[model samples]
Target: MHGPASSGWLLVALCAVTGAYCLARMRSGAEGQRSAAGGEALMGFGMAAMAVPAAVFTPPSWAWPVYAAVFGAAGVHALWAARAGAHHLHHLVGAAAMVYMSLVMAGSPAHAHGRGGSGVPLLTGALLLYFAGYVLLTGVRLVPVAAVAGGGGPAGWGDRPELARACRLSMGIAMVAMLLTL
Candidate 1:
């Protein structure tokens, strides 16, 4: 998120809106979807908070650890939940990536805004690859679904699988951007 102020604000808007939609989805979705939506909501909101430009609001030193702890717990939950479906595995990866970024930010607060870091670390590169692949694959998968679902006069908010996939795709793209900043 250590980019131009405009890009940071755009990321904030994108993630906050996604979080709001996920909250609605959690309320209106079926049992299974509700759980997934809740986790995604957490992710969206967390990303929004993290993507805030450091120049605007540098968090206290303690905040990074809190982020790491929260995402670490989420990752654990996602790992446990993955037994039920592959989507949870994606959640696990996202959570782990957040934790990694939080720790990196904490360790080098000077580099929080991309000021003075070495080249992208190995793990960061690996994560970037994973998320890039995820975004591409998810986008390709959503294409056929979007065509079929077109002009349905708008499905109920939580019932639209195409929208859900698109939401995930957006988050995947956002993740790639965030990793680049790290």
Candidate 2:
């Protein structure tokens, strides 16, 4: 995100597209999938906004706190939602990471340039490791398993498990890149 404007724009495009897909995923037939999709949608959009190139748009100083507050509330909701499924635990961690990044950005004088605190905080390092592993694990999961005995027709866009996993993987990779910028 701190790199060339082109890279930042790429991040924006990747995240925005992922967010759009997640929004569509909210129409999934499964109620639980819908809930998870909603949370993922929020995270994708938020990351897109945060990764925007500074040359394009620099948020006001107050925006960071607003980001923190919104993500904090999201984290709380994710924690509550985690009771229904373990997947929501990932959402909780993602939300907390966003809140942490927001706070760091808020305290940074050069945040508009995507520079945060003087050095990577321990928490940031931990989060980076988490996301890196998540990306790897999700990547592994995306690989095709054995063919189904009864090959059902392709799933609807909203109900495709592979797509959902891919969405999470993209976000995880994005989170790692963003953290590195910090």
Candidate 3:
């Protein structure tokens, strides 16, 4: 099978870094910290798992259905979380996109199913558009906050919130790249 090239490795690296940050954030001792850190870490790890194999190697035949089940579960959880706040809806969008890709790809001939893409133009285009808009809007939202954080925005073992946001943004960028590859 054809392996991913340099750009794919770079995207994988971003995912690793994001996952590391989320793990690091789990060390904080503040109130509600465990729950928040756990949730974010799950997201980070999930993104890495999905993105890395997608970027570097062909998925196994079972991957599409697995992805569908996993993301559909995540979507259900996100919907439940949305009852508390609207921000959770963004998770819903991401989960929905993943589940959609997985289901569509599941129907492709077995030989082509492992290539990390659904091969449905409409789905791919819609995902590209959604992620592009997400990345842009997120970047826009971060500008002022990043500016205020000052001096590289609290690097190293602190500023958990900012680091979390950065990890998420990285995942977003990585996902966009992954989709483009497909």
Per-residue alpha-carbon lDDT of model 1 for 1-182, expressed as tens digits? 57777888888989999888888878653566687998899999999999998879888899999999999999999999999999899999999999999998887754454436578778999999999999999999998895223245545687677878888998999999999888
What are the per-residue Cα lDDT tens digits for candidate 3 across 1-182?
A: 11255675666567777767777767755433334455555555665665554434667879878878888888898898878777678778877877765675566543343445456477778888888888888777766664123256544463455556666678788778766655
Cα deviation of 164, candidate 3, in Å? 1.9
Q: Any runs in candidate 2 off by more than 4 Å, and if so which?
A: 111-119, 145-154
TM-score of each: 0.91, 0.90, 0.73
| Error in Å for residue 28 of model 2 | 1.0
Clash pairs detected, candidate 2: none
Model 2, TM vs. native: 0.90
lDDT of each: 0.86, 0.86, 0.65
C-alpha-based local distance difference test score of model 2: 0.86
**lDDT (10s digit) by residue, model 2, range 91-160:** 9999999999888778766535444446667898899999999999999989973322223665667877
Best-to-worst order by TM-score is: 1, 2, 3
Quick one: RMSD of model 3? 4.8
